[model samples]
Target: MIKKPLFPYNPKYPSVADLKRRAKWRIPKFAFDYLQGGCNEELNLERNESDFDNIYLKPHYLKTGGEIDMSVELFGRTYSAPFGISPIGLQGLMWPNAPEILAKAAAKHDIPYTLSTVSTSSIERIAEVSDGKAWFQLYHPTEDRLRDDILNRLKSVSCPVLVVLIDVPSFGLRYREIKSGLSMPPKMNIENIFQAMICPEWGIKTLQHGIPSFATLKPYMEKGLDLSQLGQFMNKTFTGKVNMEKVKAIRDLWPGPLVLKGVASEEDMEGAISLGVDGVIISNHGGRQIDAGESSLISLIKLANNPKYTGKVKIMMDGGIRSGVDLGRAHAVGSEFNFMGRPFMYGVGALGDEGADHTINMFKAQLYQVMQQLTLEKVSDFPTRLIR
Candidate 1:
């Protein structure tokens, strides 16, 4: 007999916007700003979402279809959905134990969970929670020894994929973060303290979990370093710029699937291919890197349509993707897989532990609904439904 499926999502928070609203109220202002704010005027950030509105999908009312299949395969493994949680740094500041909570949810949902090198949760801890299914995103360290050590640790935990970030040559100047004193290692002034007081839930959870730190980098960091010292260490340790030499060096070192995040042009894609990288994530650091950068959608459209770059390497995208319809649009365009950072964090911030599962379920349900409406049975058919 066919068994019935369980509905796990909260109907009240059916959309990412709903989660965002609830999350904003539950977390401190500084935390909310860090999660939501983009760099400079945030024009690129606004465009990232608005650009999706231009993409139209055609539905076939008379087409025959059975059950909708949302399953997707990437890097030799199948996932419940095409999208996964993108890596985010300082996740605990958004909500206590945010990385662990999302990692558990991703594993439960059979979706990929990427852990940032600078996140609050340690690599081993996340790997343990995700049962070693989690992916690791590395920010190339200034020291080769440090890089090798981190890679070895990830290998020890049996990480399946290694994502190298290439966007932050120099960190973007986010006005909100600067204004709120939410820099690296973060400053806890009187205003920040008051903001924390207003969000009692976040405060209590933070107290329980303790202050968020750079968990992955803890081994390299000196003990008892203050915020100022930590900032100095961070600056001294991570060089933002990534050249072809750096990519090639990492390519030589890492044996697993090597993916380059922050690819926005065919030139960058070509560079990734030339260096023997396995995949490229077409992102603009969620519009936190360049204020004038093209949206990831535009880049996907350009590269996916180009025969030169289409089949050479795996192409994925992440930036301003907030809904199931957006996912469908992305697939219709060119993204083989998709990822979102703030959405999952927003999920954790909204409902704490339950938020991750709820958010994943919501995306699955919405994507399924869109597929059903279009009379498309498989995710691969989404391209055909694109109204060009």
Candidate 2:
């Protein structure tokens, strides 16, 4: 018999699609658009999920199964699950106290929860909430002083893994964000105000939490700046690109395991290995940075097939993963570990404080069910069940 998850799982929102539908109805349109939309017609975004359909897993029904251990050891820590919550900017905008809620849940579950450079909750706060198990992703800054300062802060909190973002040389042309006035210096037009008015619960929570600002970057920002000035400051602070020189500089300073995010090709994977990066998360900024790019799964398969780079560095992925079966598929294909952004955000948006716990629990239950049927005993054993 399968074990029941202790976390509350609402039957009405068993699937991520149900949570997304409820989230759309709960939050303001602008917030939901920012959380869901991708760049340049979202072709890459569509491909991310659709591509998973091509992969299949083989189940061994006759084989007797022992214990199923979903725990995975990454960068010296043993997590309760192989998957984690991918960092998202402005999490509080989706639901007030979103980062704190997720961080607390992640701590309780022994899963990694990454805190973004621009997330609403501060580094120290998430460090406290996650019991220092949270990973931090840095959005490369223009100035060496700012970069060094952020690194020093991460060191202070003893962040286990430092993930430096390599994508976003330029922001994507997201039609929904553009039309919704969610662009930098995000404008709250009459329409947005009306939408907020309709969502009284969200509005009340926002009122209690205050408007979502970059809590991590607050110390560096000037006080009493208006929205336009805030946008200008942000544009001037982050360089939006990470070059070899930047990587070298960071490698020299950060003492812990360093992972590169937004890597999508063999060449980049080789470069990350050369730079002594402990791991590379095969991502296209969640299909938000480039629409012409291939899905993250495609990138992972390419790297997995190349034995030249295997075992040299950890290869992980994060795109279009919405279900436990999807998680199984990605792991079987070549990804050592996985992460997801929208599903967790949708969870928080749908159920508020209870959302993060519910989503993590659901993923655990779903993955366990799949593994039990496959007669898979370990997360690393997922590759054996692959049809390839």
Candidate 3:
């Protein structure tokens, strides 16, 4: 007999497919494509999941297996779950006031919610929503004063962790973005206007709320432009001087856990280790940076095997993590912290505030199924129970 499904919404609420569908409908086309699409060829995007699929789980039937603890501590604080919301910028453009909605949901669930420095919501705004259960992602500025002021504000709000996104030396080559002609302040063209008009729900909501822009940068920016304008400012503001000295300087001023994101090589990992870093996430900026770049998982294998860095510094990762099993595989490969960037954003974009909880619960369900099938009692056992 065919078995019945566990969830009511789409048989299992918040599945990756369901979440994707919802996000697509709620967000404008160009905005959705940027979040969902990868660079040219998307080789790494596919590899991110195929790498996990290539690894299987070895069941331990005799081991205890009940009441699995999903809680984890990372960067000096304990989180209710092993996963946290990854940073996404221009969230307001995707869905109005999206940062607050996601932040509130993350807070309610006791998970970490990170806000990008370029996000439309202010740090204080998300702090209010998430009760400061927030981390900040800095795309380092060229102006020292601008960087200092940004850091000072984060300190004032007491954001616990500061993430430095270094992979994006230049923005990833996003083709869909080029075709859509959908830039910020959304310059309406015949094609875009027609498309926007086609999606009445999204269009009406956007009209009522007004188009979302960089609210955080409003104080700093006087002149605005569409996608090209935003891109130029991004190029100007997010400078290329992200080096060890800069990180050391940031460390001196900020007392929170300092994470160096987009470390793809062991050399970079070692550099991060030597710099008084608290954590280094092996990533390719979720396949959004380079078209031909290697998958973060494959890169993770090389970095995690080096005994010099093992257990000395916390390792985190994110890319093509669409299920709980994927999370299991990432940890098994030596990552202690796992961040999912698109899933939670897609969730909130799909169903507003409820998206956060629904997506988390969806992962909980999938993770539980994987754990029980493997007959495992705890997450720490994953390294041994892993099958190649």
lDDT of 1 by residue, 1-388 (tens): 9765444589999999999999999999998999998999999999999999999999999988998778898889999899999999999989999999999989988999999998999999999999999999999998889989998999999999999999998989999999999977578999999999999989888899998989989999889999999999999999668889988988898898999999998789889999999999999999998889899999999987788886778899999899999999999998899999998988899999899999999999889889989999989899999998
How well does each candidate superpose onto the true structure, as a TM-score? Answer: 0.98, 0.98, 0.92
Question: Between 1 and 3, whose TM-score is larger?
Answer: 1
Clashing pairs in 2: none
lDDT of 1: 0.92
After superposition, candidate 2 runs with Cα above 4 Å error = 1-8
Query: For residue 172, what is the lDDT in candidate 3?
Result: 66
Worst 10 residues of 2 by lDDT: 2-11
Determine which window of 10 residues in candidate 1 has minimal summed lDDT.
2-11
Candidates 2 and 3, the one with greater lDDT: 2
Question: Where does candidate 3 stray beyond 4 Å?
Answer: 1-14, 182-186, 223-231
What does candidate 2's lDDT look like per residue over 1-388, in tens digits? 9876544598888999999999998999999999999998899999999999999999999999999999999998889999999999999998899999999999999998999998999999999999998999999999999999999999999999999999878888899999999998899999999999999999999999999999999889999999999999989998467888899889999999999999998778888999998999999888898889999999889987798987999889999999999999999998889999999999999999999989999999899999988999999998899997
Q: What is the lDDT of residue 103 in candidate 3?
A: 87
